[model samples]
Target: MSSLGGQPILILKEGSQRTRGRDAQSGNIAAAKAVASAVRTTLGPKGMDKMLVDTIGDVVITNDGVTILKEMDIEHPAAKMMVEIAKTQDDEVGDGTTSAVVIAGELLKRAEDLLDQDVHPTVIAHGYRIAADKAQDILNEIAIDIKPDDIEMLKKLAETAMTGKGAEAAKEKLTELVVKAVTMVADADGTVDTEYVKVEKRVGGSIEDSEIVEGMIIDKERVHPAMPRIVKDAKILLLNAAVEFKKTEVDAEISITSPDQLQMFLDEEERMIRGIVDKIVASGANVLFCQKGIDDIAQHYLAKAGILAVRRVKKSDMEKLARATGAAIVSSIDAIAPEELGKAGTVEEKKVSGEEMIFVTECENPKAVSIIIRGGTEHVVDELDRAIEDALRVVSVAVEDKKFVAGGGAPEIELSLRLREYAATVGGRAQLAIEAFANALEIIPRTLAENAGLDPIDMLVALRASHEKGGANAKYMGLDVFNAASGDMLKAGVVEPLRVKTQAVSSAAEAAIMILRIDDVIAASKSSAPAPGAEDMGDMGGMGGMPPM
Candidate 1:
């Protein structure tokens, strides 16, 4: 309160909390760095996994960075911003969530040093921007082109993505499935659509039992037990229309004057059902997949006609079946025709873990496919699903971009070197920021080394010296966490899509810059407790609805 005019000035709410200037910066940086440290150890091929148990005691064990951060239950706003960087990385590139967060943490760590030296945040942000741009250019320059049909390279990419997870034990088999799935979904225009590749997991068998189906797998069972368990040379019909008698959209009143009238009404309904069945039969469809409910009478007719039918299929599964079987989804039974039927080698209901599942397989040159994942337990299968999901996305990225870079922290070291050289030309306090940015990039390799139980300083020094050797082959050298030695990632069969590197760097830098610019944090206190004396008149402390026990 100011006493100048014997008056009081109240600007902010009494309970509102505020922190500004250097305090705000340091608090935010500390929060961001703390978040980074949480995921830092889960960064490489030998990275350890985190077992997160939720409020319900449900456990999640995985080393995937995004999964770890997502399960942390973070509450601090600045820490949540760091989580956003991981999410953005995951969404954009499907890999490198750890690298992005680690870089963001290191950037903020460096920025704190610069802040202490009185270098303006704006200047540091500008220098980081330059460093980020140069890093992307260096990434592109270092990336090698891969043929979309290069199965070997694609296998390496998929294996690299799956190595540290539960799927590593069977990555060779899983890689083949990934490649096949990707290849099947790649259109003639070279665009890969991952949606067409479905992953279905069931816990029982080993991971090696996982295989790619040439067509889609509908999780539903056959509608009728009398229906054939298997159909060969199946002519599949994809139907969106309901097989039962649909109710009238508008409200209606029906009065049956006699019992015979009710019988006649049911007879009419039966005739309509028979008519629909006749249309499907005439269309040469031996198998039926319905998106809507199928009446019992319809199933009987279909089974009698030697046709297999599965009902209550999901809309997504219906779409995938169409792509896999080359069938067109027909809405009306009257429009059914021979040309509308899709062909498949077999439509069979097989018991998987005692639960029946419909497998539509052997579609010639199918545009869509499914990967059936089998594991000894639910957790293993779930982790494998996550691993393969990453592989699928990264493989698609490589196919779409037709470019990949070596993994194992090689690119970070190479970029750090190039960025430092570029920093020299831009002389000023900004140069120090650039140098800090360059130093920040090394965290990837250093963390990789530390997580593998190796000396980070020695590994980084050896890595930098190897890069300084300057050759096409040496450029591919990176810290091999598996052996705790520097090796050629390219020859070691460790590769990643180029987009992962570029997107990780850009997103981390962007997030760091955004966090650096904040000068104040004003948090309004939560609403005050309910007004006093608002309790009900009938207040009984667990005795009864009476005043006393």
Candidate 2:
């Protein structure tokens, strides 16, 4: 041990000749592992909830790994890196934040043991990378191919993800809706893009019983008492600008000496407003999508003249509707009657369950996509939103790459078996890394079994033995193993281990090797006094841009 300035330095007697600070590497590794273990139990649907309380006693309970890790008030620099990994995983996959943290923790634990044996950080990194590569190969072999008609399977997959979220039934229903919505949006080219589907929820009624309106919904009251309540064969106009007259504030007094002056002002205002409405009707538009406020009198007049109106449209939705309808969005009433009002399309509503799902499909428009989500109690709706976001990510990945695997804890179990087989062939330090990786993969199924009050060790042993006997992989308690593709029974109480193990091994290996290359963490030194216009000094570090801890 020696001193480099004020920092204590540790000089290894072997391996690379580079000198390093004593606490830097080890401290970071320890911190990363600690953070990872914190979120480990919050893995699958049965995952335990983490209650995060801030200094003010504001409490937040969630099973969302990224949310939990992000809200956690961590002080250690190493732990922060682990949190970054979770964030990256959340951003990329929209799921797996928990898995990433768990894998990082496991890897760091193994690294700590290797360091104890003087294996060196560089060597541990090398071995981990090799093991990860082998694990990924196993993952690729186990991904079950998905088909367009596998709606029930998709529901099962989603249910596996949403079981403990108080929306098991909702998840199934929403999954079906999502599948149908995506399929409907698939163009003549046999491809489905997210742009073609739009899903929305409002507070007026149950989302389950909601209807898919051919046109957009506007939460507004009739502009005038005399305006028609409903307009048929409505030619809609989508206006991005204000429909009211502009005004400037000024101190003034009005003298009502005669009714003639009042009548003149009133006439002028009415003429201007009616002129705007007339122009819209003249441009082959019988309806209006107002992004801004509309005068009650103007709305009434439009309604009286048989023009339909929808007000307070969101800018984003307004643009989308405009694109879908091929209607021009005008900035002012003067521009309302442009020759490009596009064509008016039919709007209808369909009811499903007890929720309302609004579907807007434009005749010749290119942008098309559907949003299917669950709703119930307030918390249920919030959780459903989170689930929908995750579902969207998964769907996007599936549509884009044309492949995916069963999620939940299934993949982790599958990966372990694959890694174990690969570890048997690799010798030296690399073999140790592979064995560690395999053990890490087993954590999920082990947790699942333990959570179900079964002896995890016994279940694992039985699972392995059954697989060795040429039995199928999946085994639910007291259930027969049925073929995943066909209804035929493959074996009693036995399921294929390889399929589940493959996903776990692949995702783990990919994530682990991705995080192990970092060799430095840097922080900028602050000057005693600030320079003119200089910003505050900040810390900078790197863990090779790896996923969370």
Candidate 3:
């Protein structure tokens, strides 16, 4: 007779073997389908938000599919694979995590159906690739060639991307600025250099004098009482590090023992600083870009001496500015030259209560320019700063590449339809795989539907059928992907996937098919074993519910 523990273990092994009899392909398909179903209803701008609650009771709410997938504590091996697809999508587009996974799941589901009919996996993969290529073609056909004159459309696109993130008006304004900045840097080679535009925030007031500068702007006031306020034919000095002398051991401890001693210390400090500034001026330098700190007394002296100085220049900014202006950072001020003095065009200051805003423009062939964004509150300024940053990046990409697809869920939807067409031509197993790829593309619409609490399965089927019948079109709207009938989907109030039937169905189908193709699972063993006598032994009583060997 077998021991109790050993006998139970034997029985478990038998049961496992019996369960393992199922085909690996079918198992993978099923797992993918499950994951696809989870995020099907949260796709479009009208898409509802997902509330993820962790075991610790912490909650996060957002409509970003990528964020949702990342936060989920996924345990299933198949489900984890789907999450990776979402991650890849997010990295590429900065959005559309849900759509990629959803379409992938749908593709898998369709593949499973094809597999059941004896289609080969290799054929399905080939079909899927063909479909993807075709889908790209379709996208090109539908893409609206955005021109530089279409500033309004650009604004709308930027607004759509930043709608729920806060500060709508600011976002639009910043978008316009980004477009202008990009236009400024457009080269003969058709490339836009983003290195020229810099978004900076300082403690000063608003920029009243926002003129184009040929040279770099320095935020610091004059270095010394003797430094000149304005200098013509200014020789500019760019320093990568600080000019202040290090404190000696005796200098730190010295107190005002006598008026003579105090005056001597002050005079020494001033002399040291002024000597450096004088050296710079003697070298024919009128302006200075200091990466590190400058002495207060020295600034006063420099100002009195008719020299202009800018302190705390970042190393990267210094390099760019230097390259653009043909100015070099020298170790000693004696190397500066009047010929090297880039012209300073305009410099003005505005005051807002305790804050002062300085506008410096028209410097010597300056490449890097700074836009110091200021606001009353930290949150307000931060939000404005972010909007400006996004606008700059988008405009830069648009100007540089002159080719890009609508970001977010739009691309995924297009991918699904293309995959479907290819799936029809492939052999049995290959058809299944192609269908799976198509389904993965559907996750976007399904996610939209689920967010709206609609039935993802029904919507996905409808979407697939609609695309199969050719009822979709692309155009300029608030969001990248919007149904023609929905007006402005991104701006119009949040919509459920079920409410927008076409999007719902399409997204669900795509997600389901994509998820249905996963076939393998590898599980790691637990590090620790159960406690002694803690295992369940089942019923000890005989006859009715007794443990049996």
Candidate 4:
């Protein structure tokens, strides 16, 4: 209150909080760095796995960056942005999630130092943008051309993706499986889709037991025990019609006045069921897969006709079956024709792990395939599934892009060198940010070295010097995580899809720049209900309504 203008004004709410300027920038940077550090150790060949137990006590064990970040329960807003970077990387390229997040964290760390020097956040962000673009150029220059027929290179790409995870022990076998799966699903246009390669996991067997099926495997059992267990030279029918009697949408009751009338009704029902069965048999289909339910009466008739039938098949499985078996799904039994039936060499019901499942196998050049993953335990099976998924995705991406780069941190070190040289041409305050970005790119090779129990500084220095002397071919010079020394990654048969590295760098830079731009943080108070005894509480007088104080 002023002496002459004796009045007071209250603007903000009582419980609101606001942080501005440097305090806000530092808080955001710290939270983002914390998130990055959380996933830091889970990178490269010697990286460790994380065993995350959810609130309900379900456990997940893997070193996959996206999986670990997704399992983490983050509350800080800036930290959540860091998690989004991993998500974006996973969605776009399916690998290098840890590299992206770690680079972003290191970028923020460098920006903090620049901030201390009175450089504006915008300038730092601008320099990062420039560095990221230039890094992509350097990557493109160093990337080697790979074709879909490059079987050896693709296998190395797959192996590089699975090196650190649970599948590392079986990398040799899994690498072949992944490459085969991708090659089988690739179209003539060189477009490879990972979806056509289905992965199914079951326990009680070793990882070596995992193999890709030339055909699809339906998890459902045969509809009737009386049906044939196996049908060789099978002519399969895919139907969407329900074999059971249709229920009337409007309720109606018919009073049967006499036994004759009731007998006639039952006879008509039997005749209708028999007619439907006869229609299917006339189509010359020895096997039936239905998307809807099959009545017991229908099953009995099908069994009598020497046809194998499975009911309640999933729609996705039905589509896959159609692709694998060369079949057309018919809507009505009356429309079933000989040409509509799908051909399979053998349709059989086999018991696996004490559960009955149907395998539709041996189609000529089938487009859809399956990989049945077997493991000795549930956890092992789950982790193996994740590892194989990463491998398949990486291989598919490699084929789709038809390009690859040397792995083991070769591309990162080379990009760092090129970026620093480019930064000199950009000489300004932004140059400082560009150099910072160059340093951030080195974290990948550095992390690889650190995880391998080597001196990161010495390794990085050696790697840089190698690139400086070796020139263009030095793109293959990177950390040798296994031997704790620098080696030629290309000669070691370690490589990755170029898209993974490019996407990681761009996405990391975007996330760091976004987080650095936030200068004010205003948080509204959470709304809470008043206590039971204080429901009638109201604003008290300024002085407790005293006349004088």
Candidate 5:
């Protein structure tokens, strides 16, 4: 609003409210910090899990950072930006989401302290950008390079990812499977897509019962009970076309006045289905996987021909089957040929947990593999699935990058130590912001300590002392939550991919800089009269425009 000769111009609507300058900055910062704090405790090996129950009473029991943030019902803009940081970090590296959010929260907290000292927001933003770039450099300097064929290091990386999750109950077995699955599906060029590694979960078994299948596993069973349950030396066919009669493009009424005509129509339909079955038989394919449904007559003919078939298979599974069994998906029945059929050692129908699933295993050389994860309960299975996904993703990333770092807050402490030294070299108001960033990086170790029920201050001091001593192994020093002391993380086999740390640092710094620069917040009125706490809490509580309770 502006004034003209003492008369209000009322540029905005009468009830709309605006918060400017210091108030706006503080409001956005507080909201963003609250979001980060929500998931801060769910960090490290000893971290806790959050059981989030939605309005419909469905429960999500896990501590995966991205999952938790996604479950929250946040309404504030700044808070949403904080969630984006976790999401981006998770998407890029598949781990370190909790550290990213916590670091971002601590960065804003320190920025608040600097704001009180008369440091401009722009200076803080500029210094954070500089510190972020330098932090990446320091991270790369401390990273250790490994070969793609280094199975032990890859296993350590996978174990590090699944340590804090519920999969820890059988981490050794699951870790081995994760590493094997990832390595099996990796290309010769050292590129791993992680999609070819499939995870299929089922209840009514112990966690240790999970095993990796050498080929694809389709969830559907045989269309006809009379079909052979097992096919040895299986020749597989992948079909996208439906086995049922094709329906007309437009709706039409069939006038059946004579019984003879109706019999002829039925006979034609049977003949067509028989023709389709004949083509599949001539292709020398003992096993059939179809993306579309199969008619009853077609199933009977296929069973009579001693062929095992599964209908209505998912499109994704079909693609995987093509890769796993070395088959091409034929769209038309006429195109079926012996050369187009895929080869597999055996295809069988197995009953798991009282449900039938087709297992196409023992392929000659499968590019795609499946892991069947069995658990005792639904919640256990769900959590295990999440843990395996994280493990698989981290292993793939490590294999592709061929670089890793020590976990358990080791990289953060090393980065902080080096960044502070760099801060002193660039002495200015920006130096203070750079130093603030250095302190903010410590939040990872501090949170790790606090979540572990240890003395954070004492641990930080000891960690710093070790880094200052500056030996060949000094940079790898990290707090051991299990032992309640500082030790060399690399020697203890606590390793993670370098990409996780780099992605976390860059994302955290960028989010902090974005939230710090907001100097104004404008909210439109929701009612004719203002409600109590509406103006203040609406902007600061991350629940903008919600009526006061």
Candidate 6:
């Protein structure tokens, strides 16, 4: 609002609220820090799990960072941005979400101190840019080369990912299976897709009961009781079209004046249904997976023909079967061919947990596979599923990138040490920002030590001393959380994909810089709009002044 010649000029609407300058910066930073703190303890091999209950009283228990953050109800804009970084980190590298969020929070915390010292937010942002770039370089420099054939190394990476997730009961078995699943589906050029590896869970047995299948498992049973439950040397057919006779989509009436006329119509319908069953028999497909329903008559004929069929299969399951059995989906029954039919060693229907499920197993060199995850309870199964997924994602990432860095806070310490040296040479007000960035990196090691029930200062001092030894091996030295001592991570088999660290640092810095650059926040109220002609009601003094002007 402004005044000229004793008259007021109102600009904004009546209910808008605005905060500018230092107040806005502090509020945003504080909100972001709260988000980070919420997921802070869910870090490292000794990290604790979080049981988050929602408004409806549904409980989620896990140590995964992205899961915890996503389940929260966030309203503040800046806090939502913090959640976004965790999502980005999870989407890109599939791990290190907690590390990314925690680092971002610490950066803001340090920058808040600098702001109190009267340093400009722009200067802090600029210093963070320089520091983030240097940190990425340091990460790549300290990383060691890996290869797709590094099976032992890949398993180690998977093990490191699942250590704290309560899947330790079968971590070793799951690690081996995770690596095998990834490598089996991985292309020769190093592309790995999780879509090809499905995780199916059930509550009945121990997690150790989980096993990998060589092909897809459909959650469906045979459409006919008269059909054979098992077919060996199965030639499978995938159909998208319905086996039922086509009916008029619009309303119509059929007039029958004589019994002979009705008999003729019934015969023709019988012939049409028989013709559809004949097509399947002609194709030599003993096993059928249909995307649409099969008529009752067609099922009877199919059963007589010694064919096992499942009707109304989902389209997604159809695509997976196509990949698993090397079958081409036939859109029309007339287009079916023997060569287009997929081959499986055996197709069988078996009852599991009181429900019938079909298993298509033993395809020669199958491209798609399934892992049946079994647990004694629902919550255990859920946790195991999460752990296996994280392990699978990390192993695949390592295979594609063929590079790894030491875990257990090794890279963070190395970056903290190296960045401090770089900051000294870049001496200025911006130097303070670079130093702040370095301190933020320490949060990882510090948190790891604290979670492990060790004195953070003592462990950090020992960790820095180990890195200060000034050798190639010194760079790989890190805190060993299990042993509660400093050790070389390379020999300890604590390792992670290089992309995880690089992506975390880069994203955390971007979020920090974005939050720092904001000096104003304007929130408009959720009130209804004014009348259509209200803008022109200028200087109408009282309630009785203007009438539809």
Question: Highest TM-score: which candidate?
Answer: 1
Cα deviation of 110, candidate 3, in Å: 6.5
- In order, candidate lDDTs are 0.92, 0.57, 0.54, 0.89, 0.92, 0.91
Q: What is the TM-score of each candidate against the true structure?
A: 0.95, 0.71, 0.60, 0.94, 0.94, 0.94
* Descending-lDDT candidate ranking: 5, 1, 6, 4, 2, 3
- Enumerate residue pairs that collide in model 5: none
The per-residue C-alpha lDDT of model 6 at residue 162 equals: 91
Instruction: Identify the runs in model 4 with alpha carbons over 4 angstroms from their true place.
Output: 1-14, 529-549
Model 5 stretches astray by more than 4 angstroms: 250-257, 527-549
Q: Which ten residues in a row have the lowest lDDT in candidate 3?
A: 493-502
Provide the clashing-pair count of each candidate structure. 0, 43, 107, 0, 0, 0
Estimate, for each residue in 329-369, the C-alpha lDDT of model 3 and write its tens digit.
66555555555544455544434345433344566545556
At residue 349, give the lDDT of candidate 4: 94
Q: Residue 378 in candidate 5 has what lDDT?
A: 94
lDDT of 4 at 84: 93
lDDT of 5 by residue, 99-188 (tens): 899999999999999999989999999999999999999999999998988999899999999998988889899999999899889999
Best by the lDDT measure: 5
Lowest lDDT block of 10, candidate 1: 534-543
